[model samples]
Target: MDAVGLSLMNEAVGGSEKCVSAVREAFGAAEALMIRNVSQVAKDFRCCQTPKDHQDQVELMQSLADIVMGTVQYNEESVLMSISDLCGVMTNQSAAYNEEREPYQRLVKLSQIYRSSSEEPCLDVSHEKRVKDLMDTTVQSERRAERQWTYQTCTEFGFYQTCEDASCPFSGMVTLRSQTEICLELFGISQNSLPGRVAFTNRYYGGDEPHAHRVLYVNGGVDPWKELSVGNRTDGGEEAESVFIRDSAHCADMSRGRVTDRRSLKNARQEIEKHVESWLKTAQQEKKRTE
Candidate 1:
């Protein structure tokens, strides 16, 4: 490797090692041990897939660790508790996404261990910052989508629920997604909306095409975003499959059970678990091959 490349590798691994050490000390031995194992499993494939250069990845994660450690209230409690809360959300989040089982059961285990033993901890600065960031992102995304929809309507002459073309499939089902915008426009109360979809275009988990392995794309039949999904666009390859949950809304499988949840939702999650296990086996086989 070139000197620059070596430096990048050193930085990334160094930052990651520091983070692992800090977390191990903070979360306790058993949980920490699990973290280490999961870390190992993750390292088998996770960071390698990122398109971001190693320097950027290292610096970002290092900054994240610095912020987390700085804001953490107590080493023994807060971080784990916060993580447990996140895991609890994940358990319920599956149903929303048409997911059934926990797969590895990591979140379930974390929830049990922390919820039973710990008190409700106050949000540390790190938690507050993360939550606020998410809220901001969500609001920004909604604004962008609304603006884009409006622009598309005006430019492409897309109907906002009007059945001008009687044969159009979207005529009846597609309502004004933005009630607030409709109310504003109808009342002649002009509110400043974002100009375009730049914000939405930028907000992402990662890229598409080659880097997305072990990625399960689950969507609901009723989901507006179904057209943009893997299942909608193409037949799934070995590592990527997008399954649709019938009669479910967005991410319905990711959340906890509701009495209202459809039986099809349950079946959808079973399919998700099957995909996840397949991914795990793939990862293990690849690891063995490398070793």
Candidate 2:
């Protein structure tokens, strides 16, 4: 999910204050499920310790780990959808406000000041133009400022780290007040605006990949880069490198396919955590071997 969408979900699930708890809950739930799956895989693999069986088990475990990672990606998408729904409601309300009889009369009066002052004296014109420009700039700045503020505020309230991006954080109640405060400060439109709240929401989600650093595969593949290329040089100065390239079709034969339901997702998460743990162990062993 984009930062904004994540924030909005944080809001919808439990208001801005409880956003942190909600996110933690979601993450924790997924983790627990993943752990369970890993345990089951381990139990099944433990019965077969023959060298050939061990090799098959290792491949199966890695595939299970991939499914867990996929679940994390899917959960992020689910959270984004929930946030989008909340944003839709806010947009409808804002549209209705524009059609209201006495909607923000103060801002309307301010607009008239610009419209009527167009033909005033050159000095007066220049001064008014300058003032208007300042106001416009201020409004834009404030809107941008507010977006930053709201993102931080949501983070502060929810206890989620503010996303590195200035526009939105990973979690919190992303409200219209927060959105408008950002827009007015940045863009200068108080009532009618292009793209509107949805635009803001899109910005929140669209920038998610860069923010999350989630891996993307070129094809429906798993661990295509699993085999690290380790180079060695002979005494004669000839170079050699070991590269293990798995057949993609053969790898697919090992996969369980994309699992999405909660049970499967939970299992996937566990499998991933197990694989990560195993990877860490292997890495440490390799380091020791090198040492």
**Candidate that scores best on TM-score:** 1
TM-score of every candidate relative to the true structure: 0.32, 0.19
Q: Each candidate's lDDT (Cα)?
A: 0.39, 0.32
Q: What TM-score does model 1 achieve against the real structure?
A: 0.32
Q: Which stretches of candidate 2 lie over 4 Å from their true place?
A: 1-149, 152-180, 183-262
Question: Cα lDDT for residue 152, model 1?
Answer: 51
Residue-by-residue lDDT tens digits, candidate 2, 184-287: 44445452443454456446754222222212212111221222112121222212111222212112322454543234334444544555576578679989
Residues forming the 10-long window of minimal summed lDDT in candidate 2: 238-247
Candidate 1 lDDT trough over 10 residues, lowest sum: 1-10
Instruction: Give the lDDT of residue 230 in candidate 1.
Output: 53
Model 1, span 39-158: residue lDDT tens: 442232132222133232332232223322222212112334332233233343455524423323432333344434436332122322322333343555534554555555433333
